[model samples]
Target: MTAPLRPLVRIEGDTLVVPGLVSAHSHAFQRALRGTTQRAAQTGTFWSWRDAMYRLADTLTPETIADISRRAFEELRASGVTAVGEFHYVHHQADGTPYADRTALADAVIGAALDAGLRITLLRTAYARAGAGRGPEGTQRRFSDGSVDDVLRDLDTLRTRWKHHPRVRIGVAPHSVRAVPASWITALHADAKAHAMPLHMHVAEVQGEVDACLAEHQRRPVELLAELGVLDARFVAVHATVLASHEARMLGEARAFVCVCPTTERDLGDGLPDLTALRDAGARLCTGVDSHVLSDPIEEARALEMHERLRLRRRVTFTPDRGRTPAEQLLVDASVHGALACGWDVVNGDRETSWRPSTRINLRARSLADVSRDDALDGLFYSGSAACVSGVDDAAE
Candidate 1:
């Protein structure tokens, strides 16, 4: 045979580089909860784990949140995430009172992202507590607003204040079906639409939330959202773990997006998302490292492909008639589309606003010259780990 291959950097015009990745649904604070929360099996289910999370939440000052977010964002960038969507809900002080500046916590998070050089979309959350129509639970006290109106007002203030900022975009999030009343979701949906902002929510994440919704509203969470006219193109339903077959169809029909956090779901025993079904039904798919348990975009993209592989017992689960390779299709669906889920541009060399940094995969200059772009991308998605990611930064776009 011939001699072995050589690695060289391939350049058609500028350089061979994939678009930077994004974490579409990050809870910056949850980076602290990974190993500590997972190792303790004594606490079961999302509810029990909430207690541990509550203690963690109670300990954060705005400064501490900023520090932790900077560190976390650094790790994310190093692992190839150039942008983040922070689903931030911890707004007020521990006693449910607004901080002196009101936007203190949100500002802290945005500052942290800018410090770490990652683009951020702050999805400020609306938390209207559930119970006997009373105040927030003792642990959740820091996360609530008196009403959806209060939450909307805070978001408006944030938008007005940060509209001119380059790296920060704002969105609205209603925490979940269990945490907020439907009235809040409806109003927030209206606010999101009027402002042309994306709406993010945790829908059907837990069985209990579904059961409670059915008991109270006579419909599942997705069904309730659909009934209330809250499901639409700008709406992103996170977890979506408990989507009914019909609800999945409806979600697709409505052109809504679904964010799957596979690592977090697996850690929490939250069950695998029906990715193939969701795709076939026409709903676009993206991923989130919800708890920051793992921040690898490759892993997230591969997890989607592999999960579908196991479910359907076939390779190339995401491949269609488009003639694109499985890996290319998955990368675009999982990474590029995921970035756009929170309104981030990829900024690759092909676009008019393409980011042209000196960064290169060096396929030809490294030990992979013979690796075709297709094979290189496949290896990147299927075989490469976070360790293979070389650099991340903002230069010019």
Candidate 2:
């Protein structure tokens, strides 16, 4: 029989100490759009909301992105996210021109994360055309690259520059099926495998993108990825809101991770994913604070179960097949699974992985006023908010 998961959660004094939370996917610059995009017309749908986000993306400079990212990261740290996967795509200038240094914006973002005291995985995104047979339009130009080679070269550059940094890891992200050609996905996967790096991609975030993929590739998004032979342990399919049951099984068979950004997905009116399908298929689950719609890692992780309960009209969804309890599973999804998705687990040789940070909840917090020690984790994850988190307890680390 397999041993149970260790270091589940420890209660010391009036605090509940757990592994530092992980936000496996983030778009830090979108923190600026939080209040503005909630209006009636701006949030009519995911596509309409994209219009406002695109406008905000165009207005950013290295200076502004740094400021925005710093604010986002600081809040994330305070809320118990010690590591983040910044799915950074804004590479060039407004008119699709590369900066003089080429890595200027990414540098700024990495610097900002460090400043906020968080380990960051810059998932440098690759955007090619706007869609099938179309060139990038408007703000997408800022995110697009000329060729697959360019993106790979940028990865090499980033790897070399940040090779020695203990807290920084670099991964490649193909923006989405609608943003990159199928050929690029194959090349990107090859490059990532050659380098032993993680690969992230936006998959099935919206029905329109899936429809477009079906129209062009004659296959669904995940099916195309499967045919391209990119599914692996290092592959992270983000915002997989509309995947088929078979696709979930495919990801499970490969031991791949599906990162659900519940706060951002619900905020943008995108549908929730099939959690039951993913879990039953054996796919690893993780969470992301995507779009900065909300910055609660606890909420993000709790939503995995809470959302499932609401969807299936059940109380608790996950069974302890190998004796990993539902709350323990949620903690895994919040912390280690997130770190694994960011290439933080096995990618960093001899370095600490997901266990690097530990956060504690204030037992005195109103959220846990009457909670027993055994149920503190459940209270922290479900009823408690980030407000209940006092801070990261570095001494516990």
Candidate 3:
């Protein structure tokens, strides 16, 4: 698990320049729920936290959502994130009605990211129901679509509107098995294929979701997607925390991307997925800032290894897979894999296009103050924070 680290990280003057990071699965609006969900409350369940999320979702207007999203995107930019996959689902008014301009909310989010100097992939989501035989009630109505055509129409509108914008990409997401039915998932997958778009979905995030999915579909979430022929290289499964080893095998066999949000998944009491199994079988890994619970991409990347260590109760769990050191693989998970999951090409850290920005780590920062040249990357990765990001390469657009 050791190699010369020049290709992944390079020391230049007092900074370590590297590839820009990508937060592949984000709900920009959930940034508002950061510390609020941490306090000791009576309802400590994930469902209860989700209810709190619904309340916040109900309160957002185009202007307010724009302001909040802008703030979140700015924070991500400062944290060395060049691109984001915003899994935006709030589509209609609070009362389950469409606005005069149907794409108003989506436009607001995109504008916020652009204003914050970030390359954004607005993963427009298709949500239909609360559960099996249950209509979309409460704040979910705002996320619901009457038909797959309606969802695709809004996506088409978004694509046309942002078509020529260099920093913008439009992708389709079927929210989850709970919020969306089987038919919609198939249609959304097909639509993404037709457009050659990045396809992301909330897979087995929590135990309750897996249980409900099993009861409804007689299969796990990944199993259901496989059964429907939706598992492929273009698919990105978000928060695949609760899964069988065979499920990981399915995703790996397809060379699909698993976008893990360790910070957010741990925050919500979601268990860890067998990342070793996934990697061994063939799936690529990526990182996300799902809840903005914390905004450190380094911490996010490092936690994949740390959490695995905790789960397996062993040190240096998996051997390097692709001639990369453990630190280098984690950096790829934090940067290159994320961009690729968002359907962007990445060769190395030097590229600085609208969506392909470079990142620089401050070698002089306290986190790596006395580190030797040989171990600068290891120290920066394992011990550094977003505060170590040099100001010159902070934001990207």
Candidate with top lDDT is: 2
Shift in Å, residue 117, candidate 1 = 0.8
Per-residue lDDT over 1-397 for candidate 2, one digit per residue giving the tens place of the 0 to 100 score: 4333355578888988887788999999999987887667756898889888999999999999999999999999999888999999999999999999999999999999999999999998999987899999999999999999999999999999999988899999999999999889999999899888899999999889989999999999999999999999899999899988898999989889999999999998789899899888878889999998889998998999998898889899878445766877888889878888888753232222236578888989998899988788777877888998888854322
Q: Could you give the candidate ranking by TM-score, starting with the highest?
A: 2, 3, 1
How well does candidate 2 match the true structure in TM-score terms? 0.95
- Which regions of candidate 3 are displaced past 4 Å? 1-6, 348-355, 392-397
Per lDDT, what order, best first?
A: 2, 3, 1
Q: Please give each candidate's TM-score.
A: 0.90, 0.95, 0.95
Model 1 clash pairs are 7-364, 7-365, 8-364, 8-365, 9-365
lDDT of each: 0.77, 0.88, 0.87
Q: Worst ten-residue run, lDDT, model 3?
A: 347-356
Question: lDDT at 41 for candidate 1?
Answer: 69
Which residue pairs clash within candidate 3?
none
Better of 2 and 3 by lDDT: 2
Which is the leading candidate under TM-score? Answer: 2
RMSD of each: 5.9, 2.7, 3.4
Q: What is the Cα-based lDDT of residue 249 in candidate 1?
A: 91
Q: What is the lDDT of residue 160 in candidate 3?
A: 92
Full-model lDDT, candidate 1: 0.77
Candidate 1 lDDT score at position 248: 93
Listed per model in order, the count of residue pairs whose N, CA or C atoms clash below 3 Å is: 5, 0, 0
Off by over 4 Å in 1: 1-16, 131-134, 345-373
